[model samples]
Target: MTYSGAVTVGGPAEVHELADLMISKAAVGPMNNNAYLLRCRTTDEQLLIDAANEPRTLLALIGDDGIKSVVTTHRHGDHWQALAEVVEATGATTYAGRHDAEGIPVPTDVLVDDGDTIKVGRVELTVRHLVGHTPGSIALIYDDPHGHPHVFTGDCLFPGGPGRTTRPEHFESLMSGLEAKVFVLPDETWIYPGHGNDTTLGAERPHLGEWHERGW
Candidate 1:
């Protein structure tokens, strides 16, 4: 079956395999948060994005192989509801955006910022800091050597528009960041969001102007 990137809580995860990496996406928690498990095909080392909720489900997906690290995209409570437990269970190193690290209950082992590289076995993901939804919200970019780039956008982006922001300034900041950082990628770049279904840059690129105009 094809990987549609649409997952439901308590349902099986959707898997997308690339040249050097395999991505498993699952929806967990009442909020329907999306958690992604990325395993390096060559080295077999794994990195999990967002220990959102349901440690048992996340752990089951991880199996006995245990992952190397857990990255919380932002400081949102819903995004890290299961952080402590998942980290406790796996003893995985914790990483979060530098500014929002203090907001998360678990002590972040590594404070990541824009341009930082996170390694999952031999695969390196480039971190792009996107502000607005949270002061330190981040997105991870994996430039597959044999394929188009794939981005795991936390709450910073979605299928139709950017993440929610409280202030006009925040909305502008997010839009600017999206235009400067994310939109620059090729249209084929696959975007796996923090929740719900996945979308590509090409599908959402034309709506950037409309999203900014709508101020959402």
Candidate 2:
């Protein structure tokens, strides 16, 4: 088991440690992609970043109260196909940018826009609406209250790259959002993307020009 792949982040907190539960990438079907399960240390609350090609694997990581909420970065099937199954079992609310509805098709209980905030137990997540890749794509900023800030980039950003914008219009919009949103964060922010090894906002900001040129 691995923290960034198939490993589980488990253990009750001790005197010096807080419960930082996590379930990194499990098998993602034919795509072999990675998904994330980021658990809140203080609250034992879990927030899923993407559904991927997994259902049972996600269930195992999700545990009892189920996941606190499932945040989809964009509408690609690789990121959200397991959603219905998860919702059927966990009853977690789905939150996504309004523009990516076509991919989910299912109704989103929470429709978020830029600057909207979602409270999950002790954590508060702010929405950064990023268009392109698929209009309404977004990244979630988790304010830990006491610990370091975290960002769930979904498909918008990755360890070595940003997401792809299939449409020219989406490409343009995505670049704009990248400059104004994702790149503006502090360096310490842990970027939990839909796939791959996690990186920091500081590590990615310098590559803005290349990402923009790629049309994503």
Candidate 3:
């Protein structure tokens, strides 16, 4: 189930310039969240990222192969609102950070925390907690032994922005999360952001200081 060949993202090809372009930007609200299907290009087993507003999109992506699990990044309506329906439709096990576990509309079979590992096919995502946007903002990184790391950054990092921090106390938490959890990783990780365009760990490294100075 290792996705060896090129994993073509099914979305706008203009992403080479933008930071991320996987999720449909136009589909927002009750229909706007970005849910991803992490499938082995060579197998039927798959892991679902955040469920979109249209739970049917999550449903349509399924086949006899079956959805193994549904992992939510946080409690934002945009991230997990359709989760209840997805769970009902697929019987998929759910995973979320402990802080936001209660917010998951579906029953969570497993509760994850920072440094946790969840595998789908050959992809083993090491979950990290970056909780400024919410109480349990989480990020997942697919660590390929030799290939580039693929980071599932819910709302933590953006093409030209990072997750927002509205309060002074939360600012340190955000910075610490970025510095300890995100910045500590190799510079080659490919960022798959929750909102807009995609970027790389290298591309975003320079803006850390500015983001901190701006104060959330």
Candidate 4:
């Protein structure tokens, strides 16, 4: 089941830019996981998020740019299929939610919690520990200087609604976390999910009540 639009070399076509930070994304692997390469325009330091799969493809995206860190958004297997390889090749520090640290294949160098800040060159990404998608699902929020706040929502939040959950309690937890932390932000916030196209807080805002009522 090969997915189309697999980006290999000089790929990850530019997705968006925030201040001096440039975001590039590539759809890779059978699962079509989105691997993002975030580069700091000022210092050239980069941070690759999700290292999801296709090590060779991800390596091409990294190119000669030095990666300062690789952050796994959650404990899901699909999200870290190439983590070990990427880490070995780049020697970048690995970060994950402390609770989900044991689930990832690679050793986590840094355990981040809510409110923690991760530095990519001069930019700082605030960590939001959103649970439900996984016990320790987290999202990284970057306040774009030229635009709205950009959030990397691993699988917690999506375009239509919150991520998939089996139990009602998990759904409630996810909704509450988003309400308290994410939904309160400006409506212009751009949402980059774990897979597929991106959305905005404003775009999904109107459906919050619908999601709650539907019990998804």
lDDT of each: 0.95, 0.69, 0.70, 0.88
TM-score per candidate, chains pooled: 0.99, 0.81, 0.83, 0.93
Clashing pairs in 1: none
Mark the 10 consecutive residues where model 2 has the least summed lDDT.
Answer: 9-18
- Candidate achieving the largest TM-score: 1
Which whole-number lDDT from 0 to 100 does residue 49 have in model 3?
Answer: 80
Question: TM-score ranking from best to worst?
Answer: 1, 4, 3, 2
C-alpha RMSD for every candidate: 0.6, 4.4, 5.5, 3.8
TM-score of 2: 0.81
lDDT of 1 at 116: 99
Whose TM-score is higher: candidate 2's or candidate 3's? 3
Residues 1-216, candidate 2: write the lDDT tens digits.
123322222322112122443334444655655566666566777777677656877787677757878877788877777888988888888888877866686578888899998766666779999877777788888655556667777777777676776677777777778778866667877776666557877887777777667654
Ranking by lDDT: 1, 4, 3, 2
How high a TM-score does candidate 3 get? 0.83
Q: Where is the poorest 10-residue window by lDDT in model 1?
A: 206-215
Candidate that beats the other on TM-score, 1 or 2, i.e. the better one? 1
lDDT of 1 by residue, 1-216 (tens): 899998999999999988899999999979999999999999999999999999999999998999999999999999999889999989999999999999999999999999999999999999999999999999999999898999999999999999999999999999999999999999999999999999999999999889978899
- Candidate 1 has what TM-score? 0.99
Any runs in candidate 4 off by more than 4 Å, and if so which? 1-12
